[model samples]
Structure formats: structure tokens, C-alpha cells
Target: MPSRSRYDVVIVGGGHNGLVAAAYLAGAGRRVAVLERLDAAGGAAVSGTPFPGVAARLSRFAYLVSLLPRRVVQDLGLRLELRRRPFASYTPTVRDGAPTGLLVGDGEERVRTSFTRLTGDEREYVAWRAFYARTGRLAGRVFPTLTEPLPSRAELRARVADEAVWSAVFERPLGETVEETFADDLVRGVVLTDALIGTFAHAHDPSLAQNRCFLYHVIGQGSGDWDVPVGGMGAVTGALLEAAVAAGAEIATGHEVTGIATDGRGAEVAWRTDAGEGVLGAGTVLVNASPSELARLLGEPGPPAPEGSQLKVNMLLRRLPALRDPAVDPREAFAGTFHVAEGYAELETAYREAAAGRPPTVPPSEVYCHSLTDPTILSPALAADGYHTMTLFGLHTPARLFSGDPADRERTRERLVADALAALDTHLAEPLADCLAVDADGRPCLEVRTPGDLEDELRLPGGHIFHGDLAFPHRAEEGEPADQAERWGVATGHRNVLLCGAGAVRGGGVSGVGGHNAAMAVLGR
Candidate 1:
């Protein structure tokens, strides 16, 4: 028999978003509890001793922290722990023995130059920045109101009508947007690459214009600095958990939520822990799992299924091979991150192949070598020996495992690893195999979550990470009441139950807008 306890609210999932919601609700004088299936609270934003004596972050799944709102950190007083380093990235253009045109930078100069090199048009870089600047200002205005009910269409159009904002929002595909603005193919590819990061769409695709909006929503302003915290990405989650604890929020790890019991008054959440089945009732429930996961919790009688993209792989690496770009100084090599796909055409082709349920020969890979910037992440002993840890995000692999007998899936996993290594090899002269420490064997470091699995297990529709796409209709345009209910934020179709995971309007990443906004909504703030 499980002990029955009551609370003002019960938050499911100890992911960053869930912890953020718990902290805010607890701060506001509510008795709250947080339950996590995993023993730890960070979810994807977690770090572990995958290898002995190695403290490398598992940043492969969720790399970079710049997209996180500064306001959220400040409001929560996590400044000291959430350290920021300069943004760094490099692409070495070497042909034969000579250097072609290596691109590198740390601030707006980097953003501008990266785009300029891609399209060969400085004007295009200017337009892109101007567009991003205006969008940032608009986000500042609109995002604050996200916790409230959706806005009106008139308000959305009025905000979008601003000449600068309108151009970026409606008139451009990220590829064409950059192409029209710049003449450099390299710059165009690099700048537009941001628009396609986690999506199955191509840079040149018409639907990509909305992706640009979502991209800018994350790419903060000024210097374009995407820094990692000191200890590791997990530090951010640790701070949130600390805040929650300080606010008197109770947390239980290794406890899996099995179902949600709803009634006129509120919801009764059931879970299976080490002890046994446990249930807690609350006036409001905030779910941090995917929409499909939530649906499973509600059984067959809950809200309609959610629709969105699913996350594929999250691999941790020991070391990244040294990439030498003659145009870049050795010191500047670690300044930012790198996009490995050669150009827009390659990117589009790769996405097309993946969409057909086939893994692309050349998958789009995003590499983040955080240890180069954050010394703390390096093991103290290894730091003395000068060994650096890197995170290679082999994103957008085919959702389906290769079809075959049991042995085929195993071979498929090997092929996926080979594909990832091959992609890295093509970009850098010295591939990861040369500097390798840990190799992915057996199952994939992380398998792609199927839509059915997302619904049945994680409870996310389409296994989409953002709950839903962060495009125009989903955002309900600029002035409209934010129709992110499907995304799973503060607003739920139900009266008291609220959504607070990456599935919400602001959407995924380490940002806590989903949770913070939900808290405010619950308090009717």
C-alpha cells in the first residue's frame, strides 16, 4: 500500500522546466512536490560520470546555454552559478596544403562574418542582423504576456506589420533570406544553418521562414555569445532544483508517474515508486513530460494527442579532433561551435532523405566542444594533462531503425555511428576516430523516440520536442492570444491544470519560460 499525501500542486518530471515551475509555485507560498523518473533532475540537460574519473557533460543531447533568458536567471538569482563564456566557433577552409578561407569569431562580428562568408554579401548580413534585432525587441514585448491567455489576431498583425519585423517574418526562407542579403555561399550556409538546427526541413524550404522566427527566438542579441555554464550544463538545472528546495518544494527521484486522475476540483496523479503505487491530489498539476507522455498519464480519456518533432540521439564524447582553420588562430578555435554540413544543397538533400525514413548519408551534425571554454567541466586530473571533452550532437538521424533481423538493428546502430564519424571526418581533416576515447557500441547512445513511443512512454505527440512547432500559426501570430495550449505551457484547456514543459509556446531548450509562465498563470499574475 502507498501512503496518500496531499499538496497544493504536484509537478511531474524533474526536467529543468518542471523544476522551474516547482520553484516558482513554491516561492509563491504553495506546497509543491516534484517527481522525476530518472534519479536526477536535469533530464537532457544533465551531466554524469559516463566514464570513470571523467566529469564530461552529457551536452550532446542539449548543448549551449545562450538561448536561455537572462531574465530567468536573474529573477531566480542563479547568476553566480550560471557562468557565461564567450561564444566560439570555427570552420577551417583548407584545400590540399593551403588554407582557403577559414571563418571564425566570438560576437556580432562572428555572426555577421559567418553569414557574409556563406553568401558573399555584406548587405545580407546587415539585413539578417537588423531582422534579428527587431525580432528580439518584439520578443521582449510579446514573450512576457505568454503566461496569460492567447492574444487577439489584431494585436499579432499590428506587431508584425512593423516594416522591419514583417520582412523577416513573412518574406524570407532562411536560405533565400541569406542569399538575397549576401553573396557568400559559406556565410549563407552558416547563417541559414541555425534555422534548420533541429527540424527536418531544409534551409531553402518555404516553411523555413517560420523556422527562422523560432531560431531568432533563441539566438539572443548583441554579441551572439552562446556560453556554457562553469560546472556543466547540469549546473543550471542544479540551481533550479536548489531554488525549488529553498522555496520548500518537495522532490522525489526514481518515482515514475503512471497516470493522471482528473475531476471537477483538480487532478489526482498516480505514480509507482520503490515503495509502491502512490497518488497525490492537487488543485493544479503541471506536467513536464512530452504531450504524448501526458496523454498516456491521462490514459485514453484525456486531451487529444499532441503533434511535433521527436529528439533522436544524445551522445557524449571524450575528445574532438583538433580542427585547423588557417584563417583562425589556435586560441580562437574554441570560441564558438561548428555546423558540419557543407552547403544549403547538402543540408536540403540530407533532410529529404531523412524524411523518407532513410538516414542521410551525410546527416547534419552540430558540434559543441564546451570543455575548451569551461575549465571546470574538465576532470581535475585531465585538466593537468590538457585533455578536453567535447559533445557531438548527431541530430536528425532517421527516426526508424534499419529494418532487419535482430542483428540488423545492431548493424544499423554501427552504421549510424559510422555516419556520424564520417560527417565529422568530412568537415575536419583529423576525424574523431583518431582522438577517440569512448565509442558508441551496442545500442545507440540515444535512440530516436518514436511518435507511438512518445505517446505511450514519454507521452509526447509526434515526439516533437517543442510540444508543437514554434511557427506562426502555432504562436497564433504576434498579437493573438498565444495558442500554445498544444505546446503545453501555462494555458491548458482545463481550468486549473497547466502545461510547463518544452512543449509549451516558448518551446524547448533550457529556458524556463514554460514553467515560469505556468506559475504566473496559476497565480493569475
Candidate 2:
């Protein structure tokens, strides 16, 4: 139980956003307390040693860092090292019965050569550069406003100042724009992957959910580069935990919040531990959980649980697998994202098939080898012996497919994993299974996480990674709310309680924008 019956602020969860809010508020000399249900904090952003007796510590759920703002790091004085990957991405394909692939990296000449080698001309490369140039401009304008009060849709469009770019990205469907810009199927698929990460939607879905997902993927820190957090994702939480504790914020793990009640002025938070139950009064409350969870605590009806749509697989490799194309080295190809079975037509077909209650004919996925970029995550012996780690994310595998009786779910899991691995084997010189590293128990060091697994382990309803459908990082088209807290995109039905998690506007990724905005709202900035 809490030492006292009251506090200046009571946070409902101890995820990274909650820790950030605690650090800011406590540093400002307000009594603050953070309650986490799990034994440790960090939520989805954590690392684990899954394979038995495996020395390699892998980033279990959330892997890379892109949306974390530089201001958060400097303000909290976090000790972190985010290293850039040497390459961008490599996608293997068969052209004219010959093995070939597209490789994108730092050198302009090299990239131009690769494009010319694949497409038999330079037109596609020029269009690729021009298309990203528009998103780059949008990123420069929109990313800076995340910490500020929500901007009206019209206001943000005006700030973008390029009507054509805004229309292509924000108004029209992403598929139409992509089809108009690129001719090559492989090239188009690579661009569309950004829109479909963790999202289940057709290319031309009228709701334009894909466009919102694509926008967040590209606008990180204005440059949109996803970097590896040295020492795995756990290091990020460690830094935040240290900062919050140093600022006098109390962290209470293994304390599950059961209910929250608030009138306009103050609130009471009730929680339970193994020992017993307790209640604490607070002048304010910040919820670092999903909107559905918050509604449960308030005893009110909430929206349907968001359905997650992806498969996460982690593996330890004794040696990197060989690629079909000999020109590109395995190290360079796996350094960044490695695309498989993600052609434009293939992605559309996969989405259509999965939507119709069938497994994807060709599962679209991407893989990354963080060990190539940052080897410190491995033991000294493993690193010296050429061991590497791989993280794979497969798309269009929705949570709905895994539902039914226990035996039915098992059959679904087996089929999906088999199809995904088969799709990957098409581009490799040898089967991926051949490169697996055996653990101390003489078992293959491979772990798979389905959406259902995430829901059970992390309390994520349906295991939706972003908590729910990603909203535009701005106010709605109709108008802005009159309440000050609502204007910051953190307000709930209750006045004293605010949302500080991925459910908040502009809170999709690992960014601390949600926490910062909520703090500003409470401080009446």
C-alpha cells in the first residue's frame, strides 16, 4: 500500500510516458507517484532473453527508436547512444529468370547504379527522390508542433504550404498517389510498406488510416531515420527510471490500478497488490494506458478493442544467411530492413486474402539485424564467434484469425509461421532454418509472438501496438474543444484525469510527446 492516502499527482501506469511525466512533475517539486502492474516498467519497450540459456539479450517487443525527440533526452538528462544503420533497405526479386535485388544506402552513385541496374533506366530513381522530398518537407513542418497545443487541420495544411503534397499525403488515398508516382512494382511496394506497418487496411481504403500510419513513420525527428538504441530498448527504460527516481518520483511496481474516480477538482485511485488493496487521493491523475482500459476503470462503456495485425519473430543465428544475389554482401543487406514477398501486387493480394479469412498467399514481411549495427547486445564470446540476431515483422496477420477454440488457434499459428518462413526462403541461398543457433537445451533459438500473446502478457487489448487507430497529430476537422486540457489532446471525460499514452494524439511511437503535452496541460501552459 502507498505510504500516504494522498498525493499531488497519481499516475496509473509506469510505461515510458508515465515515467516521463513523473520526472517532469516531480522535478517541478510536485508530489508524484507511479504505479506499474508488472514487476518492471517500460511496457512494450523491453528486452528479454527468450531462448533457454541464450546469452543474447534481444529487444523483445518494441525494437528501434525513431520518434523519440532530442528535447526529451536533453531535458531529462538521459544517457543513451542511438547509432545509425549503414544501409537503408534491401529487397530481393527475380527479374527475367535471373536473381537480382535493389539496395539503397548512403552513396548517391551506388543507389543510382542499383536503380539503373534493376529498372534498365534512371527515371524511377529520379521519381523516388522527388517523392520523398515532399515527405521531407512535411516532416520539417509537422514534427516540431507535436509538443505544442493541437493544431487545426486547416492550420497544419497551411503550415505545409504545398497544396499538392498535402493533398497527396493527407487528403487522397495513399495508393492513388503511389500508383501515380512509381511504375516498378517492387519500388512501389517498398514505399507502401511504411503505411501498412501494424495497420490492417487496403491501399485505397476510404478512411485513409494508412496515410496516418505512413505519416508517423516518416516524420520522426524531422528526418524520419529509425536508429538502434545501444544496449537494447531496456536501456531507454532504465534511463527514464533513473531520471524519475532522481527527481523524487516514487515508483511502485506490482501495484495494479483497479479503479479511478474523479469529480472536477480531485480524484481517488484504487489499486491492489498481492498483500491487500488500498486507495489514494490525488489532486490530478495521468493515465499511461489505452483508452479502453481507462474506460474500464471509470465503469463506463468504451470502444471495441483494437485488433492488432502483425507477427513478430526473433531468432539467434550462428552465422548470417547467404543471399541469392552475390553482388550484395549479407552484412550490408541485413544491416537495415530486408524486405521479402512485399511487391505491390503481392501486398494487395495478401491484404485481400487475409481480410477474407484466409492466410496470405505470400506473407509480406521485413527483417532487421541489430547486431550488425550494434554488437554490444551480445555476449563477448558470441560476438567473437560470428553470432547475430534477427527481428522479423510480418504484416496482414490480424488478431481475428487467431480466435476460436484452443485447437483452432494452434492450427492457425502453425500455418502462418510456416507460410512466413517459406516466403522468406525464396530469396535466401539456403533455408533460414539452417542458420539457426541452438540454445543450451539443444533447441532452435527462435521465438514468435502473436497478437494474442501480446494481449495476454502486456494487457494490450487485442495487442494493438499503437493502442488504437492512429489519429492525425492535430485537432479534428470540425473544430477544437473549449476545455484547455482537451486542447492539448490529453483530456478525458473527467477534468482531473488526463491520458498520457499511445492513445493520445501524436502518441503512436516511442516518442515522449504524449507525456510532454500532458505535463503542459496540467501546468496550464
Candidate 3:
């Protein structure tokens, strides 16, 4: 090994979380450095020129941004340039020869009725809101104390006192809860779909009721608005990178970290950069990659097995689909997020198929046309000239490709894209085939993602987006022992090393809480 040059801290993976941690540590007058495997800072939250003249988000994976803590943004001074707009989701159902379903209002309305479909009654919307308010207050009592080392015995007792709040909330399955709460099937279905996203659980499954509460815990309620960052989701990370740089943090990209060397007091990280072998030493090391990726960086036998599974697909479209909704103005369609699951059974069946490692014949998908919301992110005037760039997220798709062969993977990708387009057609009735933008050679338009590609290329464990399950074991829930929180946050059996990725805490989305909390722990603050 070369001579070790020490710093106050070292963060692994330039994903938003790692960047967030580095920024906070640097803000506190500590010398910090961030190491990213990819050439860019943002991992999934990025926009790039994959093809010449085509700049789009790599996965367009994350669409909504309500759960993120505003305190982090304000502390980092990121609110100045960050642009956001209120967007609501639409769940369409064909009734009396016309489509109709509940349109969840932004913020508290969204949170209150998140599980409305499962409740089966509109009246349950109020109950759902009540549940969120109760749970959030309980969470506040615990989460602030969870950012550091394990809580003391007294702290654990105080946090658990709030556990009684969830007693009535977790009494029923999410589907049952919704049915008992709402008289509307469409509303129940919409809420159930939200609970099942990125997981294998069915709506009727026991112990899944808490999943709805879990989802609400992360959502922003006070403002009650689900907004997309201006420019693109990439802009969020770009702003974070800028903030880190301003805070005196150094970032090195395209430098893949191969291994982590650690002792009780400090650590040495090895990476392969263009400049040949590079090593950095520091008293603290934070890993922002998925749990599995982090384990791989530590070599085999690193950490526990990953929890749950995830699959994502992104498409570059030639034009926007003409959906049948008077409320869906062409401009607002992209401004809002759309869900394809019509009912609870539909969402349940999709999750069942995904759990069985088989692709659903009609997969539930979430489609976002960024050009519809922000024209600036696309090539010149794509949104203005009646052309828009779109991305489709097929939730709960098979993590394993049907066939091990490369040809089979390609076929599966086509099937998934076709299913998403077909689902979009049900609501839009637009001929997606008419507008085709192909390569110079004039081939059919293509969708860009494969299960095999995500697992084999992106190194995602079972293609899970959050890198791990967001269940209690992985999440920072109250009543848990202090040692458990430490294991969940930074310490992973390796001394002087830590974890700061989505897998560590909130377990997905662009929220930098995990990163910020990890930095606080390492700094002994």
C-alpha cells in the first residue's frame, strides 16, 4: 500500500446520500472527501447524454419528491435554485362506459388517502390522515434521536411509548384497512398500489398494513405537495454536488472503489482511477452504494443478505400519449405522475407474479413525461412542438430475466415496454406507433432497460431500487435496541467504516437523511 494521507472523513459512492453526508461533515468544519465509482456524482438520480444529442435521466427512476426533509435543503442552501411544482396522481377506472376514480389532492390529502383504496370508503380518508398525523408525531419523537449512536435505555422507553399509536393502525391488512375505511374500490386500489410499489407484498397480506404507515412516514405532509425538481431529477443531485463543493468537499468520479481497509480507529479505501491505484485514509468511511454493492466492495461475506427485490424501466418516447381525461391537460400530464393499476386485485396479481419471478402479463406501471413538466430538460422545444420525452416505471417486474440468454433478456424488455405502452393506451387511446423516432438507420423506437442488465451491469441486488427492504429491521424504527440502529446506520461489522445509502435508512428515493445522519454519527456529533 502507498503512504496513507488522512482526512477527517471519506464517503463512498457519489450518490445523493454520500454527497449529502460529505456536505454536512464539511459544513461542520471537518475535512471531507467523497469517492464515486461512476464518473458522475449522482447514482440513480442523474441526467446524462447516453446517446449523442439525447440528454435524459439514466433511469428516470424517482418521480415524486415529498418525503425529503426540508431542513437538509435549507441547511445546505439548496432551495435557491431547486424548482418544484405540486403534482397529484390519477387512478382511472372505467365506470358506466366512462373512466372515473379519486384524484388524490396534494400534501395532506395525498397522505390521508394514500390507503383510501384499501379502506373501501371515502370516509376512511379522514382516518388515514389521522393515522399519519399520529404516526408522524411518534416518528418525530424517535427519528431525531436515531441519527447518532444507539439510543440509551431511557431513550428507547420514551420512543416506545409512542408505539401505542400504531396499535390501531397496524391491526388490519392494508386491503382490509382500505375496505373498512373507504366505500370506493378505485380509491382503495390507488392506495394499495402505493403500498406495494417496489415490494413483493400483496394488498391482503398480513403485517403489510404497517407498510402503508411506512410509506406515509416518508411523505411530506405539512406542505402537502408532491413536486418535481426543476430541470430534472438530476438537478437535485447537481445542486447537492454544488453544495458539497461549496462546503470544501472533494469529489472524484469514474473512480470505482474496489475494497475497504479498516481498523478500529480508521480506514483505508482502495479504488481504481484513471491515474492508476488510489487509496484514501480517514477516521470515518461512509458507503452510499446499495447494501449488496457495498458488500461487494468489501469483498465476499461482507454483510447480511439483501431484503426484497426491485425492477425499473426507462423509455425515450417520440410523442406524448393522448389520454382520455379532461382534467389531464397536455401540459399538466407530465407535471403529474400517473399510475396504471386500476384496482387492488390488479396490483395484487402483479406483485404475486413478480414474487414468483415471472413477468406479469399486464404489469402495473408509473409513467412520467419530464418534458411535460420542464421543457428545458429535453432537446430544444420537444415539449413546445407537441413532442415530449417520457419515462415509464414498471413496478414489481420480475427481478430475474425469464431466460438466461441475452436474446431472452431483449425479448423480455420488449414485452415490458409493450405492456406499459398498452396500459397507457387504455387511458390515452393514442396510437403510440404513429410517432416513431429511430436511430439513423430507421429502426423501431426502443426501450432501454433489462432485468439482466440491471443486476449484471448496475450491480443492483435483485434489481431492488432502494438497495434493501424498507421494513423495520432495515429502517430506523423506535423501540429497537441501540445496537440495531448502529448496525442499520453506519457500523456493518467493519471497524472505522459506515453505510450511507438508501439501504441504510429511509431505504430509497432521493432523500439524503441517511447520508446526513451517518455523517453526524461519524463526527461524534
What is the alpha-carbon lDDT for the whole of candidate 3? 0.63
Which candidate leads in TM-score? 2
What value does the lDDT take at residue 87 in candidate 3?
A: 57
Is candidate 2 or 3 superior in TM-score? 2
Clash totals for all candidate models: 46, 0, 17
CA lDDT of every candidate:
0.61, 0.90, 0.63
Compared with the true structure, model 1 gives a TM-score of 0.83
Tell me the tens digit of each residue's lDDT in model 1 across 166-267: 455545665655656656455455565566544445665676644544554444532344667777767788888898888889998988888887773678
TM values, all candidates: 0.83, 0.98, 0.83
Task: Go through the candidates in order and give the C-alpha RMSD of each one to the true structure.
Answer: 4.5, 1.1, 4.5
The local lDDT score (0 to 100) that residue 494 gets in candidate 2 is 88
Error of 3 at 340 (Å): 0.9
Alpha-carbon lDDT of model 1:
0.61
- Model 3 lDDT per residue over 119-173, tens place: 4445666755664566466555544443444554455445647545444333456
55-109 per-residue lDDT for model 2 (tens digits) = 9999999999999889889999999889999999999999999889999996989
Runs in model 3 with CA error above 4 Å? 1-4, 54-59, 79-87, 105-165, 168-172, 206-218, 221-224, 303-311, 316-319, 325-334, 401-403, 435-446, 473-488
